[model samples]
Target: MSIELLTLCLILSVFLVFVTGLPVAFSLGSVSMLFTIFLWGPHSLQLITHAALGSMTSFMLVAIPLFILMGNILERSGLAETLFKMVYLWMGPVKGGLAIGTVVICTAMAAMVGVIGAGIVTMGVIALPSMLRRGYNKELAMGAIMAGGALGALIPPSVAMILYSSLGKLSIGKMFLGGIIPGLILSFLYMAFIWIKCYLNPSAGPALSSEETVTWRQKFAALRDSILPMALIVLVLGSIFIGAATPTEASAVGAFGAFLTTVFYRKFSWRMLKEACFRTLKLFSMVMWILIGASCFSRFYMAMGAADLVKGLVTGSGINPWLIIIGMQISLIVLGMLMEDYAIIMIAAPIYIPIVTALGFDPLWFGILFIINMQIAVLTPPYGFALFYMKGLSNEITMAQLYRSIIPFVPLQAVGLVLVMIFPKIALWLPGLMFE
Candidate 1:
């Protein structure tokens, strides 16, 4: 069969499997296996084996479970509750303060946990009720939590970034650095939108009543409780920036530090430890299986001259490279609506990275942009992970409300993406400054 026909068949086969509602890992693996056996007489199965083995043995992948363990431990440790208390004590007097504080706490949680599920659910359980009780608009309250929680995809120690950097053969430390600025930019945008909306329409988010406010002394006490968690963030990201540790080593430090936080808070229990480990194992196993399957699928596709075919089409076309880049971003957003962020990275990075480099774009910059797009994806309707997470938070929150909540922040995320795209320095400066 011609490469074009084969490529079309491959795409359709994957789509059909996805429609069948099979797990992503199995879908990719089964499709790749059937194609190999049919096209190459089963002899090519060794290639898939090697690819899966390589993914399993990767040293960088060690960080995934450790970071996950850290996040899980911290999630159960009451740190998010402490941070939310801190934000509430200080910001409650201002209009939209609770919603803005939700964003701030989510950003801090993103630094500590580097995953969205914990942040979204934790904040939803903690901050959402407070905002709603204080008469904050439901859409605004839900949007802030969803958007802020999505920052986990763009912030340091992000498992998504780790996987993207590993698959793209880029520096993990640099990719981590690349995300910091863009993540903060989006956080600021979310907070700004909340403040302005509440400022214009005070009914959307009213200042906390004086009776409900805390004393300045209580506010300071809450700040004291936050110090240890902030220190942990500094330790993890600072070590990477100063070259004191590889990303893997920093992950170890993070995991230990997370345990220490639990100890300090007296939240540690043998049962808590067991639960954290179990959660880590389950999440890491899911990620690794996807990695193995994607490795197999990517290997087969590349072996079939997929790279040359993509390069020829992209380079031979008279389209502007910038337009091509925009097209790729749009495609990623659409894919995000369908696939898990990890699977999208695994499948798309192999095909897109080469084209990005050939077009004279920095892969690191493009990787950060891809992550920002995912930030939007997780909050988008129908299949957005964050949207579902919000719905699962309470039976009262309908899917329709979750969808409407994210409408404003999705565009804010896009603005952040566009800024980074127009000025690569937004994503590249820190990485370049530190490494160069």
Candidate 2:
């Protein structure tokens, strides 16, 4: 058979395996291995081994485990809780105060820990109970946590951006910096939606009593708690942007900083260290497995010339590259509604990235757009992991209620995505300044 037919069959086989509900890494790796051996002979296994070793040994990927460990340690140390309490006192008592605090806390957590799970679970436990107790609308309360937590993936030091940079072969520095502005924009979008929604319907998000509001004196004191955390984030991120350290080295710095922060707070303990390390190992293992599978699958597909196929088809179809880019975004949306963001990134990104670059696109700009799409994807119906995550934390929230709460936020995520799409500078400018 021709390479084209082999590529087609390989892709179809992967989809079939996915549909069969095999674990994502297994699905990709097994499908690729099956095709490689049966069709191309046993020697094809060497390709799988090479791909696995190359992917696993990546220096950039080392940052993944370190950053993940940092996030876990931060969450386990009670520092995130202290940070939230600080923000809560300052921001609470306004309209939708707790919801707003969730955004602030999630952003702060994003700076410290780059994983969505950290933000999601931390806020789900800490912020969710407070919002519910304050008589906030269930959906709004849940939406705030879910929406804000997803920001971790876009913000600097973001493990999602780490993987995105890895797959897209873009600058990890620029990608991290590029995500900072947009991450803040996404956070503000959540905050704006909170303000507008609560303003229109006061009953949905009730304001706290004047008694709950912090006096100026108390606010000033609370600022001390935030100062150290904010400084650490700035110090870590700044070092990477200013060329003081590579992303992996910065990850090392971040982990050490988080440790010191925890110790400085007197929250560090053997128990916390053990728990953090365990969690990091688990998270790291999951992503590494996925990476291995994606490596093997991409290798197999490329061997069959699928990348060239996609490039040729898109170009020869006589479609404008801009329109094709739009089409790619739409496909992501549809798949986002169905698949986990990790699965989408691992499986589809390999195919899509080559087509994007071949069309004269900047992968950095496209990475931001892709991250924005993932922010929206977390809110999409039927299978969005963020929605499910929030639901698990909230006993009173129904699926329908959770879905409705995200309705407005979804459009806002799309607006952010479109913003990146149009203004490449939102992603490219900061990185450009940094490199130049």
lDDT of each residue in 156-266, candidate 2, tens digit only? 888888888898788899999899889898899889989998899988788877666567888777788778778888888899999999999989988898889889988
Model 1, stretches more than 4 Å misplaced?
Answer: none
- Candidate 2 is scored at a TM of 0.97
Tens-digit lDDT track of model 1 for 1-436: 9988999999999999999999999999999999988889788899889989999999999999999899999988778899999999999999999999999999999998878888999999999999998889999999999999999999988999999999999999999999999999999999999999999999999998878858889999999999999999999999999999999999999999999889988999999899989989998999999999999999999988998898898889989999999999999999989888988999999999999998989999999999998888898766799988888878998888888898999999999999999999999999999999
Q: lDDT of each model, Cα atoms only?
A: 0.92, 0.85
Clashes of each: 0, 0
**Alpha-carbon error at 303 in model 2, in Å?**
1.3
Off by over 4 Å in 2: none
The C-alpha local distance difference test score for the whole of candidate 2 amounts to 0.85
Candidate achieving the largest lDDT: 1
Candidate 1 weakest lDDT stretch, 10 residues: 374-383
The lDDT of model 1 is 0.92
Q: What local lDDT does model 1 show for residue 290?
A: 97
Worst 10 residues of 2 by lDDT: 206-215
